[model samples]
Target: MTMRTRARTMTALLALAAMTGLAGCAPGPIVEDGPGEAGTLEVQKVNPADFAGQSLSYVYFTDGPDEAATRELIASFEEEYDVTVNLEVLPYSDLVTSVQARLSGGNAPDVVRLTGLTDFRADLLDLRTYLGEDYAEEFVDGPVKGVLGEYGEMLAVPSDLTLNGPFINVDLFNEAGVPLPDSEDPWTWDEMIDAATKVQEATDTEYAFAIDKSGHRVSTVLSQYGTALVGDDGAVLDEAKAVEALQPLVDMMADGRMPRDFWLGSGSRYEGANDIFLAQQTPVYLSGNWQVGQFADNADFTWAAAPNPCADECGGFPGGKYMGALAEGPNPALGAFFVQYMNTTKAQQKFIVAGGFLPTRVDLTERGVQYPVRQEDMDVFFADLARTPDLGYEANSQPSYTGASLELVDELALVVAGEKDTTTAVSDLKAKSEQLVEELQP
Candidate 1:
């Protein structure tokens, strides 16, 4: 059947399930029915024939290359299990709205992909109940720890890992006669600005660097300065540390080294720094490993990933996408099976090789990612991930800090637009973040 027809069919099925109260069915204890032992990753214990007529739905938002790889995997799964998967693909911008709308209507998909699983923990099924606790050991600690729900529930299975850093145009540095920073002895934040200024002076580029319009990217700078959004007690943003972290960005904008339009302009947040970098209007782009495939295909000039600059310490965001089954979905058993299937060693290897993502599995790391091109650039990102401090991981992983991290992005935009000075912005942000954390408390 055509994809559109399958989607329509699934929609009708979901409506039926909701009306019949099947969508709210609580899954019974998992009973292994196949030849292989239960809860073992080595064999498939769930019989395909048992779910032969079952139809499932999934929602995902991913980049071009990852999307293609997912489609291939879904096709293989459908053929093997004789089940139909109604995959609804959306842009990153629309993913949250679409999922929430479906959920409120009592028709959430059986499975969904998300970057921040903790945000939806209440609606997600605890995979540990079905997959067994031992299965969690297959993945790396950072990715696994980031997805844990309150009360220590395993809410999701990580699909791939990513590290945030900078991508520089090698050609721009060569043309400007600026020596590249040594990866072993990376440039400090001040040194990064100096190098960028030299390149802008020697070339026609409008800006020296383009930071991704994200609070998460800005948090990397905060981490380097030893300031976190949350401390042991609650939301914490030291005034001095906040200014020290934000001052350089404000200065760069005033001096035309960084564009104000990119952050405070009419453009949407999804319009990333890649545009300026690809246009050769900026010598450096601060983003993450997710851009590897896009840059390999589109960038016309010589470029490579670099270790993020440091103040007191080197840091980068340790993040990745995860797959989870919804608690209110029609079939939790099938949903859990599909989530685990996607993370199998063979499946993960194929995804990393095809999509150029860092592996989340411990064994796959030793095997190494086999990028079709630019393996050295991938190595830089891998090294950055290795050296990332514990605070960097905690900033992204902790549930209490999620709201605060998002708020920082807006406050940073205000500082860039000259609406608020760094001191006032940080002070305002601390108050707002504390309120958010209090509301989340039990």
Candidate 2:
């Protein structure tokens, strides 16, 4: 058969698997004896046999650490089911826009792996029926929030959770004679800043601390302060706390505790301070779990995931990748089944270990992942993830949060650059958030 003919046949076979509306020939004689007269034809009920030679398309972001493991999982699924899945890889920046465009144009792929769900929620297939209630309840609270729809339907399953926390140069701390705090008794933000400042001064480093120029990472600091830039009601819950959360960052930039150029120079685009930390020029780096694998391989000095520092609370922001099926796809049923397969305990455990990812599954979170490298550092991040405040989840779950939060980052950057005061910047953020909420509301 020609490749084009084979493609058409595979598409029809997969569509017939779950759709009761499609009636046609397959490999041959898929129909069975049913309750109908001799001259009449009754459509056979859907069954697994319908998927025998079917095909599916899945979109995957290329930024993940365990691309090979993910492909292995897909290959296993295809081998077991005698089917095929076309994996379309895109960079993280292009994944959302491309998928959303396809969705709007009614050309979405069968399955997709994504981070933000707000824009795609309308197009996502509800997997509650296939995944079941008991299975859906197995996810940890914060990670699960990222996959739920407006009405609490499970539109996607979260995978490879990330948490924003600090990593410290253990060698620098030891060099400065500053003792790192024990895991059992973690220090507050103030104490952490003091230790970092001392280490920077003693070691003659350029900066004591550095954080990603991202609203998402900054939310970690905001959550510790018992607030977020935008609340569930599309406003700041504690305006005073929002100001307090941001003021320290502005001050840090001015005092050389942080690199002013990193924040001010990046404009509104997301930027990281990983190079400075990896070069041993900074005592502390405020990043996330995703960096562990990279740092483990590249950092010259001994580094470790530090205990999350507290202000009013002790935690970091929660975010993750999500696997979902597009409702408009040719084979949503097959797509959903694949999503379930990926979320199975065996698959999740392997993916976690291979990628050094924090877990979204409750059991995995409790049992832990024994990464081949830097297991202890991974433990610190997992510990902080368990303690993440609800505010972090609520703030990000808002449909307007992504766009508004980007604006918040740019506004705060103006404050860091001394172009705007904290009070005015925060007020502008609240106004911008409210405006976005109105514009984005369905």
Candidate 3:
């Protein structure tokens, strides 16, 4: 099917386009205007005719609607510039390892799509010299920070933004006679559990909640409880906060409100909870906005995105991918041009609208993109993004947090599976994370 045709089909499948409120703590001051208002700089634009016959290679993962949108962008670029782009699409599972192998072999693609730039910063072309400092201001702050290196180098161009929260089975709530919380009034952690219990008893669902078995997803609870995977000095997860963050999942499992086999299930480390959710075995699923498209296209029951339950505060990990030029690539000029071109306002709007993604541009966030489907769910997601605490942004942007965060997930799994008590698990995690952070330091 054509890209536009597929988008239209996805839209048709998404018949529930009603706006929903998202609950969370208030956000810090944010720039509500477009990046153009930030500033302007006179930077040299790429003259496509300068290298009409030049060839460039680009690599990226293929998934969902993005693959089609990306190909459309490449076709437009290739046609306009009169250059040949050897586009290499890899499966999500093979993307990172393959890119690393190629880079190690000194045969890096001219431009590549990356989710995190920190590890690749040393080998990435610093774009500030080409795109100008002013150009960087055009994107949203959270994503910009994610692509910025420790020495203030622009390692990548931010292309999109995504945030995680709760997706509720609306029909189950109605059947359970539990009132949904509005954006103005979000439920606290205890309150959410109370409501989930009601839904479980009334509906006899196999599980009340099933969170994605990802460290990033679990970090939302840690962030909401006013802690991060890594602190300013080092790894600083206190026992109290650790228990406060992890105990709820443990308690839910003990009460039979959550499936013990999902996280601790007999499967690979990559096992997911999305299957249980899609089967309607769970009333709530804690995942990122990426699931919106899948739920829209595949769900047989009514559902809506809800604000994350708050403890001391409410927040979620800010995530998105970026396009970066390899410093060791065949053509730096072409790579830089493509990176900047792909993130331009027009290009971002086209991709965001076509791919059903949240825009990385502040202005696009405020003005909104014309998503072919799930517009209302997108609204709740944006609202949740706005309320996310600055600390949450800080946590995800740090490279050191990567290893520590994974350890947190593994250790927490042990706790959930009753392999280790919360105290022992937290202690071991704290020490290991601290060591990992120290080892990662330059």
Candidate 4:
């Protein structure tokens, strides 16, 4: 398949909360804000002197049915502004199509939720003119890049940026007598291997890392090699870079750097990678900053994070998940409003404290987004995100990312089952991927 095919839905990613109800939204699954107590996202408020009267429309993906906190925010915002936002809520899957249809039909809502590049492309409002100069430059490229349309016009604003780094079980490291590195000093892949081996040997744990979900595991490895499973266009990928990124995991597993039984079917839950690190089953797990919540929730262990390992030449483990907007919305005005609203330091600070998602722009992170973990650890997570995150577009960005990444099923199974060496297996896959990218680009 071509890159275009791989560009969308990498999360399974993509979603906008509200859209014109005249049409429907994704019904595949919706995560509504549950009965988890109504909590407030600390809002960065403006002094009344600088505030203006403006009503806007907002569409959001409810954790599921309407979330009380979201509704509460809507009420609060409405009371404060001449801005009357017509709120539209919808399912995740249908969010894009429904909003596109509404905007095409001249009924687009003012603001909508967004996922990847495609959403921000096409016709979303550009925030460059609005912010002027100083404000825009403060953010890192990862968040800003996701916000653009065709011409680098700022489309949507990011509320948070998800970044990955090594989550180290300090207790395990200490027990094993392994020297823990400072967050500022990142590990190299070789150093990581030695350290992990030492940790496992001393503790008798079966793994140095766990693969609860391979999302973080795979992306960082691929970045080192210079290929990604998806391309900038959001399409299926086959590239030399991808081969480089993936080879080490195969090697690490073979060398017993990780648990032998930790492949996809190992029953490790998707959200539990953090728990694994905490339990000391693994000494190091590549994880995102959103995990600040898990760290905050855990008190028994004295764990901390280190920056993601980097190759000698290039730096940063690619990050995933930045917010954006749909080009065509039922209401462009409201869409633009949301774009501007969400990216502000105030909104991001709110997301940071509650959800543990790292604020994308340097402006917000610098101000100290809340987390219960050590100040030094939080600094490491943000540095990685700002330095390097999201090396490739998500599956939806390139439709083929999911399917193409999936194509390795047979070949990977071959290697995993011991039928092939890491070199031979990846070599064969690399040829196919290179051919595929060539076909997609032309």
Full-model lDDT for every candidate: 0.77, 0.78, 0.76, 0.54
lDDT of 3 by residue, 37-120 (tens): 222222333344465789899988855788888889989877766778889988877878888898999898899888786567
Each prediction's TM-score versus the true structure: 0.84, 0.87, 0.87, 0.69
TM-score for candidate 3, residues paired by index? 0.87
Query: What lDDT does candidate 1 reach at residue 182?
Result: 78
Q: Candidate 4's residue-wise lDDT over 238-353, tens digit each?
A: 44455555566666667777554455343322334666676767888776655655575763777777777766323344433444444344434334444555555665555455
lDDT of 1 at 250: 88
Clashes of 3: 0
Candidate order by decreasing TM-score: 2, 3, 1, 4
Q: Candidate 3 has which clashing residue pairs, if any?
A: none
> Which residue pairs in candidate 1 have backbone atoms (N, alpha carbon, C) closer than 3 angstroms, thus clashing?
none
lDDT (Cα) of model 4: 0.54
Task: Give the per-residue lDDT digits (tens) of candidate 2, residues 152-197.
Answer: 4567898768889999999999999999866666789899989999
Task: List where candidate 1 sits over 4 angstroms from the true fold.
Answer: 1-49, 231-233, 267-270, 400-402
Better of 2 and 4 by TM-score: 2
